[model samples]
Target chain A: MSKEEKRLEILTAAMRIMHQEGFEGFKMEDIAKEAGVGKGTIYEYFESKNDLFLEMLRFSTEQFITGLENSLATGTDLESKISNLSLFGSKFLSSHLNLVNSNISHLSLPEDSKDQIKRYWEHIYKTIESELAKAIEGGEIKPHIDLKMAASVIIGSLNQYAFKKLYGTGLPPEQIDHQAIARMILQGMQK
Target chain B: MSKEEKRLEILTAAMRIMHQEGFEGFKMEDIAKEAGVGKGTIYEYFESKNDLFLEMLRFSTEQFITGLENSLATGTDLESKISNLSLFGSKFLSSHLNLVNSNISHLSLPEDSKDQIKRYWEHIYKTIESELAKAIEGGEIKPHIDLKMAASVIIGSLNQYAFKKLYGTGLPPEQIDHQAIARMILQGMQK
Candidate 1:
């Protein structure tokens, strides 16, 4: 494999370990074996297990943004488009992504990692913001409201609900009424 | 002071250190000195720094719930009531509370801590749910809507926005225009 490809392979191994074992369960020696690389080779690429984990987080975030772009494009209108976004959120929460994010928070984040987090957030917010702007022009929603605030409402509502479900309600991902959630965000709580 | 009161003093000291220096900066001796207790006394109350921090978290959560109950009760109508809630959320995000929550997330949460988190969420969600029920009765919002979902939507929207602003947009709590946010949740994005 090319040098870059080899690095990618190691990250994938790390991700699997994280999913199966969680943050606390991650073991560098196990990751080296899983990646089919010598333990020394693993160190050559990553300074520490924490470094590899940070890289993996950045990689996954990039993947999420890319995948979101494709799924969002498949929606036929503002309503369906947003519903797709909400469903993706459900799927995201169901995965190890949220857990990983929370687990990494206590780490003394490096400046680059902080910047990456900022970028990840901005990238997602813009995707939602653009969707809202499109809906405005298409008359799916009124143009009078603040687009940023509107976007925040939709994002925050879905984000918190998904997070709470991880512990509070314990709903299965397949059983989540994502369409209703999207509708609620679009239409508000009014009758 | 009573044993319970003495423990509370140590937790408060720990919170101060966390705010000043974050999790990495927390020093047991520093807290003991701040609380006007011997290091031995701290051990008598809590087994370890992690144990002490967890107790501090739970203590703060309880305080939050009690304070919220009072502020939420002050609003005379549904609009004001919900606005009060959102504003409280803004103040909360701006405080050390959100920072403390994130900084502690990676900790291997004990069962008692897990239960505490669940209780905190349920407590908050119920508060919002009760407000919505009253609004429904007052005809401020439609009774046709699913109350639980509606509450989730409101909570999630405010939550994500506050969290993102912590890094994504960097809006000050006072400058957040929370009434508009509350209105958007009540009226939605649809014109």
Candidate 2:
């Protein structure tokens, strides 16, 4: 098999194992066995188990960003762009709840790894920020609204909802009725 | 000292140590030393480390609930009551960001312990729900607004914002301006 394809296969297997067994429980030997690769073969691609797991997260997030950018590019107006983005986010969140939950959000990491995660988050936020700025410029939203705070609120609220789904069970997720929640947040509940 | 006073002192010391070093780093020996009690005396007060830690959370949250209830009781109108409750919530969240960051929201405990936490949260929500219901009945809110969803949205959104604060660096929180956020949520940004 091609090296790139083999690497992808290993990553997929790693994610599955990590999701089921958690970060601390994951072992490189088990992953190699699960992926049908020689133990040394994993070392050829990744320096350590930490690298393999984090790279999997990076790969998934990069794909998500690319999908988001493509979706946003299709819409002209800020409203439609944001609408599409939030819908995409909702579906993405529901589909990858396991990945999101598996992210060791609390664990301390090596400096370089920590920086990579920070940059990834910053890039995503900047993309959202620009969209918000466009909406404000287009007069779709109130002129004086703090775009940063609004963006933070939007991102924070949705992420929190997703976090709640991961940790607890209550609110029906976006997959069940995307339009209802999208509508509720976009337009305040007041009459 | 009296039994209740000694128990209170132990819990206070436990909280201080846990907040500084986290649950994993929270050693029984340190707690006993901080509380000025023999290691065995800790068992006299609480059966185990997990039991002591969970009680620490319950003690703080109960104090928070009592403070909020006092604020709510002072107001007659639904809007005023909600406003007071929401403000108290924002303040409480800012103070307890670390506790939430530690995943206290999703803490897994034994059945009775879990039930105690659940009852505490339910009671908090129940207070707000009934107050909102009364407001709807009194026509304080718009006649058509869904009080249940509205209550959830308010509580959920505020808690979500507080959770976000723990994830990223921002203005030193003193300048976070929850008052302004409360204003926007209660009254829209629209002119």
Candidate 3:
């Protein structure tokens, strides 16, 4: 594998370890062993433990965004498009449940992570916001609705619910039906 | 002062330190100094650092819960009650903003601290949920609204927004406009 390919392989292995062992338990030796790489090879890709962990988080986020963009682009109608976005959120968050959970507790984020998180949600909000605005303009939604608050509320609601399912053991994730949740929110925002 | 009074004095000082310097930066000596008590006095009240910290968190949560219950009891009409709840949320979240921000950071939470967080939030959710059901039954809100989701959504949105504000500097706290936010949320949920 090329150097870049090798680096990606290493990160993938590190993420799996993080998922199974928790971030604190993640060690360089474990990643090296999991990746079938020499400890020296791992260093070539990441300078320190913190650096490797942060990079893993960034990579997961990038992958999510890229996948979201591709999924969103596949639909033509507004309903399908919105459904696609929601599905993307559910499935992606469910799969990367650990990393997302770790974002609040395991990762030592840099100053820039704030911008990255805002942009990430802002992108999701803008996408949904544009659709909601269009629907209102098209008379599909109530014209008087405050689109900004609606967008923030919807994004915040689903994101937080999904997060609780993924991170919070207090409530079992199975009890929450995503379609029911989407319907209630969409209905509340409906014309 | 009696031993109990002195202990309460030490806890009050510890809370201030935790609020200002965060839980990680809190030291027994600093709390003792702030409380104007000898270091040995701290040991008389608490068995360990973990015990002291947990007691502080529990104490603050109790105060918050009590204040909210009082607000709920005082408001008679549904709209006024919901409005009071929103305002209460805005005030409570913002007041403890620093301490909450400190706790969510990856390195900040010790493993033992996790259960305390879960219990605290679950209690808050249940309290809100009960009020939500009462509002729905009393015809204060549209009967069709999902009380559980509404409670979760409102709390989650405010929390996330607060989290963003804490991490995303350059945005002054005044920019948040708590009253405006409360109006937006209550208006959206209004019949």
Candidate 4:
């Protein structure tokens, strides 16, 4: 595989290890084994466990962003865009349930990792902000809407459901109706 | 003071110490000083620092619930209810920004403390859930609404703004327009 593909492979393996072992029990040797690569090969790509975990988080975020962007690109109407985003968010959150739980409850993460995670979330918010701006410019959503607050509301609402499921307070991920949620958000944003 | 009043006073002091010193720097002696009680007197009420902190959290949550219940009782219309809730939420979140920040980032909290915190949040969610139910039953909100998800959406949206302000990513608390946010939530929930 190309260098980029190999890096992606390593990150995927790291995420699996993180899911199975959690942060406390995570081991680099396990990651290497999961990646089907030698220990030295894993080290060549990542300096340490922290480095690998951080990169894994970044990689996962990028993948979500890419999926969202693709969905946004295909939808011509505001409703479609919102629906696509919500659906993608639900599926993504469900698949990354362990990561989301760890991110919420794991307190031992280093400061740098925490900052990186915060920045990644900020980037996600910005992406949604731009989408809202486009909707407003197209007269799809109300022009009077507070873009930042609106974005936060959309993301927070969607995330609340994901968090509930992860915390075992809500229905299983398969039972959540993403389309219904998208409709509520769209209704809230309408002029 | 009556025993309950004294407990409230002590909890208020604990909250103040938590706000100013954060969880790590928090000291029982400081709380005692702030509460204007002797160290031994503090032990009379709370068994330990952890117990005091947990009770303080529970007390704060009860206070919030009381405030919300009073407002919900007074509001005649759906709009009034939503407005009152959003306004109260904004002010409460602003004042407790430090507490929220610590709760989100502090990982060293004992498991029982964490469980207590989680239960506090669950209590808050249930309060909102009941309000949503009342709104629906009174024909204030849509009958078809998913009460639990809707409540989560409202709380999560409000919290997102608070989180952003705490993180310095959004407007200061005083500058946020709670009415606008309330309007958005009300609009979304309306039939």
Give iRMSD, candidate 4. 5.9
Clashing pairs in 3: A105-B106
TM-score values for chain B across all models: 0.81, 0.79, 0.75, 0.76
lDDT of each: 0.72, 0.61, 0.62, 0.68
Q: State the lDDT at A141 in candidate 2.
A: 65
Residue B190 CA displacement from its true place in model 2, Å: 6.4
What DockQ values do the models have?
0.54, 0.23, 0.27, 0.25
Worst 10-residue lDDT window for candidate 4 chain B reads: B97-106
Candidates by TM-score, descending order? 1, 3, 2, 4
**Residues A97-125, model 1: lDDT tens digits:** 45333223334577788777777767877
Report the C-alpha displacement of residue B110, candidate 2, in angstroms.
4.7
Which CAPRI quality tier does the interface of model 1 achieve?
A: medium
lDDT of 2 by residue, A1-191 (tens): 89899988888778666655544447888889888998999988888877886888798788778867875787775545645665666566544423432123434456677667767766876887787677777776677776545655555444444443433455444433334333444454444
Q: On residues A77-102, what C-alpha lDDT tens digit does candidate 4 reach at each position?
A: 76677667766766776555234322
Error of 3 at B184 (Å): 4.8
- Cα-based RMSD of the predictions, in order? 3.1, 4.8, 4.9, 6.0
Which model is ahead, 1 or 2, in terms of TM-score? 1
Between prediction 2 and prediction 3, which has the larger TM-score? 3
Provide the global lDDT of candidate 2 against the true structure.
0.61
Cα lDDT tens digits for candidate 3, B1-191: 88888878988899877655543457888998899989997888999876787777777777777866776787775445545655565566555523332224233346677667667767776887788677767665567666566765666555545444444433444555454444455554223
Candidate 4, pairs of clashing residues = none
